[model samples]
Target: MSEAFTKSMARNIFFGGSLFFFLVFVGLTIHTTRELPERDHRENINEMVVLGKKVWEDNNCIGCHTLLGEGAYFAPELGNVYTRFGNSKEAIKGFIMSRPVNGIPGRRSMPQFNLTEEELEGIAEFLKWTSEVNTANWPPNIQG
Candidate 1:
């Protein structure tokens, strides 16, 4: 009811707002930690998946393509590529191996890396693993 501005009122408002936010932050942190494991979707740890991740990094696939909303958007999102390719790792590998080297004119394309069969398979496995991860339905479409 006081019309006059006071330092005590300002101090109380600042402290009250900060305390409310700090409690909110702590509650959210606890909830996230408790829910994380339940939200994890990784079914198994396959050697192929690990190898595929190595292949992906070695080739710098993230340089052009995004995985789970990370990396460049110049290329299609690969997070759900396994699903897009009909859940077949072989199909994914075939698609990658089929690209033309240095790309083709009049078409946005991926260059052929000429990867070995094992490496190609590895990349596919990694992509499959990524697809299985829980991204909360990212990309919002199956095309990703």
Candidate 2:
């Protein structure tokens, strides 16, 4: 015997699917919460990192640079930049500080933000913090 298609059947199917998806969502949330501490490294976040984040957001740095595989691809991935720069924050600072305001001729270049010394330190520290995040090997290259 073939089952008849009815409103009740439709309603039951909808409710069942909803319940199943809800449970799946809850399970995923729990799993993510459990995994966060191991991955987040929230304990290391400091005032310097906070200021660095502010500087980044204020200047729209993400518009040109990618961090941890996020943001625009116009420039380079800064996720592993600390490691890429020979574990030196000073190198990162120097690169940022040395950018010419008008950019190089015949080539795309980073704009000079004219950041102050404090802001530079803050950004450097922030980059250091970002490099510490567990990205599971992103950027696919040491240079970026």
Highest TM-score, which number? Answer: 1
Q: Local distance difference test, per candidate?
A: 0.85, 0.88
How many clashes would you count in candidate 2? 0
Runs of candidate 2 with Cα error greater than 4 angstroms are: 1-14, 101-106
For model 2, state the Cα shift of residue 38 in Å.
Answer: 2.7
> Evaluated with lDDT, which candidate comes out highest?
2
Model 2 over residues 1-144: C-alpha lDDT tens digits?
236788898899999999999999999999988988888698999999999999999999999888987899899888888898998989999999988647457777788899999999999999998888776766668977
Worst 10 residues of 2 by lDDT: 100-109
The RMSD of every model to the true structure, in order and in angstroms, is 2.1, 2.7
Q: Candidate 1, after superposition: displacement of residue 142 in Å?
A: 0.7
